[model samples]
Target: MQTGYADHLNLLCDMGELISVLRDSDDIHMFLDQTVALVARHLKAQVCSIYLYDESAERLVLRATMGLRAEAVGVVSMAAGEGLVGRVFDSLQPLCTGECRIHPDYLYFSEAGEDQLLSFLAVPIHRGAVRIGVLVVQHEQADSFGDMDVRALRATASQLGSALENARLLLSLGGGAEGSAGLFQARTPSLSLVRGKAASPGCAMGPALILGMHRCDILRDEAEPERSGGMACFHAALDKTLAELNALQERFARRLPESASLIFTAHFMMLKDPSFRRRIEEKINLGLSPMAAVRAAAGHYIAIFASSSHAYIREKVSDIEDLACRLLRNLKPGEGKDAEGVKNGGIALAGELFPSDVLKLVSEDVTGIVLVSGGLTSHVAILCRSLQIPLVIVEESGVLRIPEGTPLLVDGAAGNLYVRPDDSIREPFVRTQAAWSAAESFTGTMSESTWSRDGGRVRLFANINLLSEVPLAIRSRAEGIGLYRSEFPFLIRSAFPTETEQYQVYRRLFAAMPDRVVTIRTLDAGGEKVLSHVDSAGESNPELGLRSIRFSLLHRDVFEAQIRAILRAAEGSVCPRIMFPMISSLDEFREARSIVYDCMTALEKEGISYHSAPQIGMMVELPAALELIEDFAEEADFFSIGTNDLVQYMLAVDRSNPRVAHYYQPWHPSVLRALARIGKAGRAAGVDVSVCGEMAHEPALIPFLLGVGIRTLSLDPQFMPAVQQQIQTMDLREAEEHARELLGMSSIASVASYIGVEKRA
Candidate 1:
């Protein structure tokens, strides 16, 4: 609002006009060089520099400069919050100082020749929540910069945000293929090993199928008049993409588990989102063609998603790009053929893969995937795991440039990739592969009951996540369903499912396994598995905060609705058991049970047919419940040992945190003691006890569990045969003797050493 500020604003606008006239063919480095020179001239400053944030390194890299030494352009860099530029970026505010040497956060670099520089002004450059970089100006004289200077620099940076983002995206996508020589760096595969994160656990050996090599040239921002039929063309493509997604979702639901099928639901939601459509429409209204409009809109979303610190949010970038690519393919057929050359029984090598792309690979029977972008917990990685496909995330982008048909062996369990391996590597993996294939055939029939050599029977149940997995459980010969995670349905949806919707899902679950016990856990929606629709946010430590049974009690209406759905869905079912998770106290268990009774009563008053006496149980997963097992057993009908949470809570380690994941040992002495104590208490009180966590399916721990009197074991359906085979190999007497010796040990190392197979030698 000052006269000088108004004049400076006009100057910034003039700089924007100059930037707008620049063409797509202009080099990004040239543009940055010109912009900095113009800013220095306009502001009458000694130096002006542009520092961009490199997300992978978490550093502010100096990209261009006007007055500093030319060599320092790419060499000078600092970590976020390491210097004055970082302080401005961290605070997202303009910073000006008259005496740069006296400032506490000032960082000096000799290569920049800024020792004599006294006046400094910096402003954070960002678009919405995305932090792009920082723009700074310097002067030789003290107090040379003023308020007008800061305001002008800030305005100029704002105008540069969009152009910089577009340029960056174009450069990254376009620089890969200079010609055939650069694209095909290696004609013959070299012997080498690359390491990455293990996404899904398995081994795969096959020829590599290179993908994502096509650089669609639709991202250029050139002047083009809007076509007359652009809206119609856009709508036709939109409908086709939606249809393709629907078919994909249906195919996955029919063939894969519900979790894998729901990966496409986000695609469907985005296509139907009003805001996404509005963005494209706005671009079209601005005289751009339909294809260009979609690209511009998608590029905006991709930039925002790629800038996020949260891994989950950042994963959305692929989904957005996939949608745009699909739309462009529909808009103009035959172009952007990135996946055209893929074949069956091959390994997919790419920079990154979308969720739909993963499903397509599964359909084509691709053996494994080697990605340069995805994390272990990403949606595509989860889909690969659910589909039993091997996936490894490597940092080696050169794999994309490797010749087609290169023999690549992926060790998903070890996170290693062997390129054109010799017999030394091939022979062992071949034997392992043959042995795995033979074992996976699962010669044992599912109808036969499993028993130890000492004649103690052990029941095997399936831990179901969705209704689609019920058939898998039945085919695997699981006697019943245990630990049905009730939170997954809530997690996938944008809003809480209504009672009718919940009842329908539950009905399908019970109808699939008639006359068999199905232990459905109540809403365990907190901690790491927070519901998007619920107001359970801002907890510093969510694992110890309102979660599990505590969360169910706090939101009693949600608990009762879920209870009512379960009760109503179990009208004709013989054995439907309701279980509560994370019960830390006696009062929590009592309150949850009281709510179950209230739901039953309310259903009866409404003249609805419902089960009156579904069995109630509690998961003994906390140390408090482990120590006071007798008290909980006295009040509860049965106990399910949720070993995943029990081990995490008892050891005070976040199993999901990679830094402390090693400390989450289920084989620890105290964890074993707690399991043994719970089994003893349950037997004393005549309460049926079951192990329904990951510990149940572990082949090494099955004997120990039976020794501790845990007769019922629940696990993933895929592991049922292996656990059954392990049970058949063990004698209950030997297991009991081993359990006695193991529980007597005080140290974890002693327990591990005593049970280790090498110790027997």
Candidate 2:
């Protein structure tokens, strides 16, 4: 039994080397030939053959062999369940027999020269649920294989699955065995161009800094170390990681959105969570070293979260990984890597970067990022945009194969990436880079208010995410603060911020825009903007479940605290408005408004100076609210069109889902009608109506919005110059006529076609 364990350890060590070889191998066919020969030698088997499933043909074709006739490698094939090898593939299980000739599923291939084999052992190779191929060995002597041999071959087959899958993907991308070297290692590789979504718009040229390659190493469940004080070492590291997270959060608090900076808050919460701690402690009790225990516990969560279909849940995988890395770094301080020294002024190439990793990479002064795989709505992309880092996300694996320090030019606006671009490509971007820099400075060219060519005026307000954005809004000459997402403070805190704590934040926002109207939206938590302390984690359909105003109402104590803070903060401010989000019914609106009034009355009774009658508003996000716009216009002081959710709910499409992202059309006739209806109703009722969603900043949609009588447009401060320019070029009368024409269109395609022609005209 002791010798069996020794043999297994030796087998694992040998297999690890083989896995490394497969990763670095340029020619997959050559690697397979070497794999067969080496496995035959290791197992002392006469025959070692590899059969790869041809997906298109639905047959298992012999790909490599060590002891069979070499010419029969590609010639021998069989359907699943047609032979011993086929039966293994069909069952997805290992098969071992002393006599294979008389087996029920046996079929002979004369060219293979395998008739002499009396003993057989075959194992299926797969990646996840995907069937890749089969691995088999045979001996002329009966009963030559045992359970140990079956386990050994099974382990080898498992390692081959991933390498074979990568090869298959490469072949599908036109990288055949002969062309693999040219595609990856040539002076000017033909397959070096990659197109992806432009998460942040800008140009950057630099070498590639590959990240996340050693991610699997973090998940390895190694045995206990031969050292005392393992538990003490782990506690020290955990404490140090917490301190680092807090420091980083505070350091970048002024530069990033509270939500973005507080990304580390999730790490802190995970550390404090009993389950995470318990899991680690349990592993340690079971004789794992503290370092190994931490990894094992983290790996459990990472695997579960990464397998989720929901993008939000999957994104948590990165957070957990970042935390694990931080803990590991603290455990072994000298092992810490300095990104600045290794790849400063380079573009980071990663599978996916968590938000914390984004901050780290940016601090190292990396020029930009190329994500070989990631979602569009990843917080990493958001951080890149906020930090003004150029970012492009591609679906290609070839980007990962680029040699370290290879120059890459990223055209983030066009979503184009050129590997090792020549001077011709660099010259245009270099010339434009200076101009782009100058353009972003925005030297007060536009006036405070935007007016069309025909002199119809529109009020352009800034949607402020944090107090840091105030200077930018003031610089852009925004008319007012149309929307201030009030959830940021709540999102970043481990516990809910107290009323006074909330007041201080609100006071800064109100003071920043002293003369302009500041519309503060109440806690819009849940949905995608989840609160860290909330109990909404297990909700299967969170988007449609308790969220937004529902979350605020369900926890009235929390809602009342926020409202009281807003009232207290509004003291001495010229115009402060409070808005409620996701109001589906009049009762929901009435109930929320009653809570605000209740808070105001409580402040009055307590002799606390407060803004008694700040303008109360409702966000027009739900389809039900759209239908009842007239009723809402009468009760609500203003209507802020939250078109992001409006379009999503109206079309029944999750905007973040790439599969249905195209279907989430704000230009849909139904959405246009809804916007028009709300605009007309607000006008009829003498109430202010503004659009504060992504549609507001989109220059092309400005005319349609203006013609629909949406006089107030709220958008990100960065878009002010372009939006001002677009408005200045438009004639309001022409815009009105265009809006009329658009309303008559029944389909999104027609609206698009009409707009295309109108632009040309």
Candidate 3:
């Protein structure tokens, strides 16, 4: 093994020990003191201290120390951002430097007796995204800390933050006047407010429907207990939980975007980790019930993750908590369910929810969802958006303290949840909801022909993934179906949907649209959406690998079945159009087209009464597709710009990855230029061009699309009215001028400013 790899493994082992110490300790002061001492020993540093932020005072007080004078522990305090230690907490990043005493930002505290220290390292300790404290280590020698040493210190700080928060919570509960009884009493005001990321956009006012909480009672002592039976029970519950997770993963993979299904995969991996399983087994052997063992083990990891400063790592706590709950409930069935008094139409409140839990809320017809723990990109959040249900993630612990059935108002657009909102606040939200409903009704009545103020006409189409959405498309009066994702039926089914089954589905979709054009993109499944029956090793980076047209061509039987079905569906009245997705090169598109031709010939030989060959097109999603647009325009019947993937590929950013999602800009000058190039190519070849990505729904981008000469747009049915409103208000000439100016802009901020300035005018 490489020396660096060995060193990393050793560091991880040490971190595990540090975590054990934090989890086992109960006293806050002793825990803090031991943490500083252990950190000083681990790094071979001369001094280590922990400074916790006092929110009320707006300063960091020295809570624990190893090398400082004993008297300085409680007395030493610095204003936030005033000293080296404070700066770490304020910036939420680590700082390491030699000759720290000479730095411009250094502030020496005489009482701490640290004048001799030359090298210093400080890392912020946080609970998830919230800053809590700073962990500092100092050395008498210059340049004492290396990169590895800094990393070790940071990991220790994360554990310390979580442990401290847990200790504080216990302290509050134990020290209160009413002791444990005080825990149930609401600490938050009657009119409380909390903010979270807006997973979906809408507004609703209803009573809070709190979900049932899971609890496990640990039996600490039982002499001569049945250890083997407890272990057996624990393992059985673990197996069941894993099975449930696998099923949930598959369900989410079918119903939601590929990114949304990853949480379950992560949970599955966590469950399989030997160390985690061992921890639960150890607890089981200690005479605890099977459910208690699972809860205890989960809590240990949850506390460690909950204290982390990194949002990504901290988010894992929720997943772990959910898994623990599932294990407990599996061990004792019918334990976790909705509270008895929960009524329909109320906003659902929960500490966390799995994808299945959210589906239950949908069945109950809940008006909104407020989760105390969940990320904006979680599967449940995605499901809520698809169901068009408002969801808000409340981060404050006080949210749990709010009484069940409390009148709550959820502002999903603003990411705010109000507890017992007054008449003044509720009145405006009611009006807003009414306005939205009226807008939807008015948009449904809009004419099928969409025209700009300057008489430039654009065909508004609907993007549908399922047959259920066809009615909404019809109601919106869309001229045609722009992009009908044909992968949904395949994804949702347990096995490959038979050729007859696919034909029937296509027949239904074609019949629904009738004479209106229906562009069905051939099964674009691969990458994140893998078939269970396919024998394939998953790609390291699936996005750029075997997907879309490539997958269809490789799996010829599947491709042939879909093509035959599409052709048969077009027999009499339906004018079906077939579009191939993720086509980067002309050869790939040609190969896919040849398969369709082969299918048509086979249908003719079989005496199948199939209609004429449909208009074949390619989805312009890759940067390579844009470059070869003119070449493709020669043979292709039409080109639909999938701005979602195109922008991501052009910018080299994964939109689903939170770290770089901000860089996935549709307004980027390069993306605009590419779109314009495709538009020119399509117009020159007399091929119809359209955009069917989320960009089509954005009203701000409608003018730009018109300016780029795109004459057709396919989007969600709900967005048609607003986009039509924006289009009707626009003058084609002014839009072209604005588009030209926007293309000249260098940055996203500049383009946004230009648009904002124009909107005000």
CA-lDDT, candidates in order: 0.77, 0.78, 0.74
Give the Cα error of residue 88 in candidate 3, in Å: 25
TM-score of 1: 0.69
Model 3, poorest ten-residue lDDT window? 213-222
Model 1, residue 295: what's the lDDT?
82
TM-score of each: 0.69, 0.67, 0.61
Model 1: residue 736 alpha-carbon error in angstroms: 3.1
How well is each residue in 1-761 modelled by candidate 3, as lDDT tens digits? 01143454455466556545545644355556566766665576777888988776788988777666544566688887887988888899999998898898999774565756899999999988888899998987788887877787787777777777766667466576554334223344333566667888788788877663221122112232333447767778778777766665555444443223343555677788999999988887787767667667877887697565454455566567567767665666444342222467888877556655665466557889887555564556656765678999754434554677789999999899988888898899988888778877986679878888889898999998667677878888888899888765564323467688678778877888789899999987766555434434436687888888888888888889989999998777556799999999999989988888888899999999887668999999998888888999999999999999999899998877765877877877798889889999999999999999988977778888899889899998878888888888889999889889988887777877776533211
Off by over 4 Å in 3: 1-191, 215-342, 351-357, 371-379, 392-401, 411-416, 422-431, 490-501, 525-542, 605-611, 656-662, 729-754, 757-761
Model 2, global lDDT: 0.78
- Candidate 2: clashing pairs of residues: none
Q: Rank the candidates by lDDT, best first.
A: 2, 1, 3
The most accurate candidate by TM-score is 1
Distance from true location, Cα of 433 in model 1, Å = 3.7
By TM-score, rank the candidates, best first: 1, 2, 3
Q: Write the per-residue lDDT of candidate 2 for residues 1-761, one digit (tens) a residue.
A: 11154565576567667656655655555567667766775676878889988766789988777667554656689998879998999999999988998888788874565656888899999987888889998887788888888888888888788767766566446646555433222222234567777988889999888774343343342542433346787888788888877866766665554543346666888999999988988887888777778788888998797666564565566678778877765665454444213456798887556666777677668898988555454456656765679999764444655778888999989998998898898999999987645655863676878888889888989998778788888888899999998866675444687887778788888888888899999988877666545556458788998988998899999999999999999998899999999999999999999998999889999999999889999999999998899999999999999999999999999976765887887788899889999999999999999999999977667789998988999998878888888888889888889899999999778887876623211
Q: Superposing all C-alpha atoms, what RMSD in Å does each candidate have to the true structure?
A: 13.7, 13.7, 13.3
What lDDT does model 1 reach? 0.77
